[model samples]
Target: MNETIRALLSKLGGLPMPVADLADDADLYAAGLSSFASVQLMLGIEEAFDIEFPDNLLNRKSFASVAAIEKTVAIIVDGRKVA
Candidate 1:
C-alpha cells in the first residue's frame, strides 16, 4: 500500500474503512473524517512513518487532502529528522 493510503487508514482509527475505495484526490474530511479522528490520524501517521508532524503543518488544510498529506510526508521524508 502507498503511504497516503496507509496514512488514511491509520487516520481512520476504528471507523472500519476501506482504503482502496478512496481516490487519491478524495476529500478525507467529507469522507466520514472527523476533527477528533483527524488528530488521532495525525498521530497514527507520525507513528507509522516515524516522523513528527510539524507545528506549521498541524492544521485542517494539511489533513484535508491525502495528496497534501503525502506531499507533507514527502517533505518530511526528504528532510533529515530525529527518530
Candidate 2:
C-alpha cells in the first residue's frame, strides 16, 4: 500500500522532488503539492484502491504526507470490509 501510494504520488503529486526520494513523513505540501494537485492525487488514490474516501477524510491533514495518505486509505479500505 505504501509503495502504491508512493507510485501514485510520483505520478500525481506534482512535487519538485521525486516522491521516491522523499521520506515517508515528508511534508508533501511543502514539497510542492498544490491544492489542485491534491485533488487529483485523491482521485488517483480512489481509483487505485477502489475505495471512495469518505467526506470526513477529505482534508488537508489526511493528505499531509505519504504516511497520512497510507493511513487514511487503510482506514477507508478496512471500513469497506465491515460494511
Candidate 3:
C-alpha cells in the first residue's frame, strides 16, 4: 500500500520530496497540492485501483495523504478482484 502511494506521490511533483516526509495523516492540500491537480490525481487513483469513488466521498479529506487514499481505496475495492 505504501509502495502504491509512493508511486503516486512521485508523479505528483517535480521538486522531489522523499516519501518518508509524508505522514498518513498529513494534509495533502497544505502539502502543496493544487486544487486542479488534485482532481487529476483522483482520476489517476480511480484508474489505478479500478474502483469508483462514492459521490459522498468526494472531498478533500479523502485525498489528505497516501495513507488516507489507501484506506479509501481498500474500502472502494471491497476485496474483489477477478472473482
Q: What are the lDDT figures for the candidates, one per model? A: 0.71, 0.93, 0.72
Global local distance difference test of model 2 = 0.93
Q: Which pairs of residues collide in model 2?
A: none
Best by lDDT: 2
Q: Which stretches of candidate 1 lie over 4 Å from their true place?
A: 1-4, 7-17, 81-83
Worst lDDT window (10 residues) for model 2?
Answer: 12-21
Q: Which residue runs does candidate 2 get wrong by more than 4 Å?
A: none
Model 2 residue 54 CA deviation (Å) reads 0.8
Of 1 and 2, the candidate ranking higher by TM-score: 2
**Clash pairs of candidate 3?**
none
At residue 31, candidate 1 shows an lDDT of 75
Residue 47's lDDT within candidate 1 is 78
Top model by TM-score, which number? Answer: 2
Better of 2 and 3 by TM-score: 2
The count of residue-pair clashes in candidate 3 stands at: 0
lDDT of 3 at 16: 37
